[model samples]
Target: MKLLMAAGIALSLACISAAEAPSNYETYYGGVRVDSDPRLLNHYNRVLAYCDREASLPQRGSPYPYDTWHILALRSCLYRYSFVDRGVHSYPANWFWGHVFEQ
Candidate 1:
């Protein structure tokens, strides 16, 4: 029982350390779970913020129009999630079994 408890504790810690923020949800489709680097998340956030202002948006005829920043930010969030899943979480291929089995 002691050995079982110790193993459980160690595994739970590993899961906790690997878990990513709920907002970080980018890499779902490609079977690519990227554990996000917090540094990268900060960088993406700053980039999105700087481009959010009306004045910062590109002119109407420019490729970097108002919508550009919105789209980029959305993409960034997706990437953050994907990176987190891939790089941090050890959600094995058989995680569905846990859902079905674990109460």
Candidate 2:
């Protein structure tokens, strides 16, 4: 019983950590690359802050996890701030699903 309890605790901890882990969606999608331009960097920082807040909330009418919503929010925020023009316009649908399943 003790061993089983330990295993359960470990599994719970693992799941919690995985859920909270930051997504590499920005890196994969190539939006808002950091550079020497201070103004652009500031804008990037603001976008990140906005996405972080957006990701923290439980998304209504969506079944996906926090990180998945985070990816969507980040992309939207980047496009809203005009950062996407400097990077690739779009990503394949599989890429989004891959991240979703990774969690």
Candidate 3:
């Protein structure tokens, strides 16, 4: 039950953050343009999968949790892929927060 509650809260936060996130801004990583939406989506999905797997692992004495790392990775991927000027927001279903709860 605790896990479910935590997941719910995390999801709520993700959705809220997603709502406020900038949209349709061209993204670049290491001075290189990120021109492919599919590539970014793939990276986001991979990070999410890693987060899920790590969340299921036994807790350790580390300073940062696995979820933290994975979430950051996902965020970075999103940051690198999203466009701010284009204002393109057609596929909400493909967004990270859109289906985070379904995992």
Candidate 4:
């Protein structure tokens, strides 16, 4: 559930085109999301890293549970990019039949 949620969050921030958006998370994606489609790897890995970072930061013995706002903001940012940019709003669903057919 966490992985999927994270993937959804990250995909929201991904670029719709190779030329669009900054390549801020591409390197991270290069390491994860093993699949036949190179594009899926690019999308999933980026989201995975962002979530890992966000979730891990709060786990390093913080005095308080990490701020929900910060986490929500991350997901919101992803949502913004997804909606405004019409980018990959979700994970492999973008590559699935319904989503792919929409393209």
**lDDT leader:** 2
lDDT of 3 by residue, 1-103 (tens): 9999999877654442222122333445343233346675455456445544554444521234334444344444444444222232323334655458668
**Once superposed on the true structure, which residue ranges of model 1 sit more than 4 Å away at CA?**
1-35, 54-103
Candidate 4, residue 76: CA error in Å?
0.8
Note the residue pairs that clash in candidate 4: none
For candidate 2, the C-alpha RMSD (Å) to the true structure equals 11.6
- Steric clash pairs (candidate 3): 24-83, 24-84, 24-85, 25-83, 25-84, 26-83
TM-scores, all candidates, are 0.25, 0.41, 0.27, 0.25
| Global local distance difference test of model 2 | 0.48
Model 2: residues >4 Å from true position, as ranges?
Answer: 1-34, 60-66, 85-103
lDDT of 4 by residue, 1-103 (tens): 9999999776654423321232322223333223445775566457545643554454432222244434444444444334122236323355566566887
Residue-wise lDDT of candidate 2 within 36-55, one digit each (tens)? Answer: 45665665677767655665
lDDT of 3 at 67: 44
**How much lDDT does each candidate structure score?**
0.43, 0.48, 0.43, 0.43
Question: Model 1, residue 61: displacement in angstroms?
Answer: 8.1
* Backbone clashes, each candidate: 17, 0, 6, 0
For residue 54, model 1's alpha carbon misses the true position, in angstroms, by 6.1
Clashing pairs in 2: none
